[model samples]
Target: MAPTIPGFGYRRVPVADDVALNVAVAGSGSPIVLLHGFPQTHLMWRHVAADLAADHTVICPDLRGYGASDKPSETDGTAYAKRTMAADIIALAHALGHERFALAGHDRGALVAIRAALDHPEAITHLASLDVLPTLDMWDVMHGTGAAVGFHLYLMAQPPGLPEQMIHATADAFFGHFLDVWTNNPQAIPAEIRAAYLSASRAAVPSIVADYRASAGIDVEHDRADRDAGNQLRMPVTVLQQDWGAALGFDAAALWNAWAPGLRHTTVSCGHFMAEEAPADVVKAIRDLLARC
Candidate 1:
């Protein structure tokens, strides 16, 4: 079973006729939707979501394929695109009686929130993107040694067949690599929760592959089209990320400033999984962003 926050209740929320998100909801104020990253489900937000619930209705959902959510076998890759995933989030909040809400995404989910802020600007009251760059910028920054970290980005970007076969061949190790390396504090994810993530990710090999593959192809295309058009995030935007650019030789804040004027970008001292690694900071950053809106 997926880990749960004390007061939250589970719901299978229908975003479309064939797709429904397994969501956890709690509290009863302005709604704020939290999206999880790769190799994880909404369960990643256990602490942060629970904290936010004190003053906000927090909705954490498995992004269509990672947990007990619907995982369609189709692989055109467009279905897993951030644009489509963003729509799922918007539709989910609407279904739960939220017309305009704060949206936060960590890792893969950050990409979706970025898309949501770009595509449906009016619907998002505030936006918090944790530990990621835009798709185009992400690809643009990786070069030579800098590109070494994104081995999986190139791996899954290849046309489907092989990536799925290889990962499925040894799913736990593949998923566990991130859980192992991405966190500075092993205590952030205890034994049982890590097991849950590993199990869910192993079962979600296909959709996870398709989701990353979309980033390499369609997600980049969507991002380029926006950058070319001079689109910017209209809402109050806060980006909390590890200073990857410092180590990787790029200006993370400058790249984000190009897309988000007056952006509240900060270099967090934590591992890649900020929500879990630094839940208090993540919660405060999100709360601060919403207060601005």
Candidate 2:
């Protein structure tokens, strides 16, 4: 049997005419949606989600084009854009009877959360982002040899054919690389969960690449437009991130502050996979974020 969050019930909900997200939901209070990041599934939130479910209606979903979710072909460039993905999230929340909810996401999911907050401000009562900067700041801060850390970003950002083929050929190594390098405590993920992440990622190569490609193109364009318009995240916002600013030559908080006037930024010592390696801290941060709202 596939791994699942303990005590959570699973279902598939239609977000668009052709798209449905695989969602794991539990608890029964004010809803809070948790979106999983790249190269993984909703299972990444097993630890945190279980904790939050004690007092909140915790909803964990594999974003479109990921995990067990539907992977629509990128027939048009807009198919995998964060804007489109964000809409799917909003629709999912509505379909689940949540007119508004608190939202949190890690890594690639953080990008989607950012877009959702910007596009549907009223639907997100509070927002938390884990370990990632907004798309515009991300591109701006990456420069020189330091940027080498994100070779995968550049690889998938390439136009179509080559990236998909290259990654597909060595899917395990490519996906496994992040799982291996991004966690401080290997046991936090366990042998089975790591295998599941690799298997899911290996099966979704093309759609995953399309997601990254959109970030490099349409996602950037949307962020730039929002910045130009002086639009900010109107909800109470919290950000937990590793201290990438010191090493990357930029202020992570300042970048987030530009987009979120009501913001609390924290620097954590954990690795990229903080949700798994430091789940208790992740839970505390989220609970504090909800308190603020």
- Top candidate, metric TM-score: 2
In model 2, which runs have C-alpha deviations exceeding 4 angstroms?
A: none
Which 10-residue span in candidate 2 carries the lowest summed lDDT?
242-251
Clashes counted in candidate 1 amount to 0
Separate clash counts for every candidate: 0, 0
Per-model TM-score, in order, reads 0.98, 0.99
Mind giving the per-residue lDDT tens digits that candidate 1 earns over 1-293?
55676789998999976999999999989999999997788888999998999988999999977888998775566788989989999999999998999999999999999999999998998989999999999999999887988899999888879999999998999999989988999999888889989999999988888899999889999999999999999789999999778899999999999999859998789999888888989988888888894
lDDT by residue (65-108, candidate 2, tens digit) is 99999999998889899999999999999999999999999999
Error of 2 at 178 (Å): 0.7
Candidates in order have lDDT scores of 0.90, 0.93
Model 2 has an lDDT value of 0.93
Report residue 54 deviation for candidate 2 (angstroms).
0.7
Query: Candidate 1, residue 108: CA error in Å?
Result: 0.1
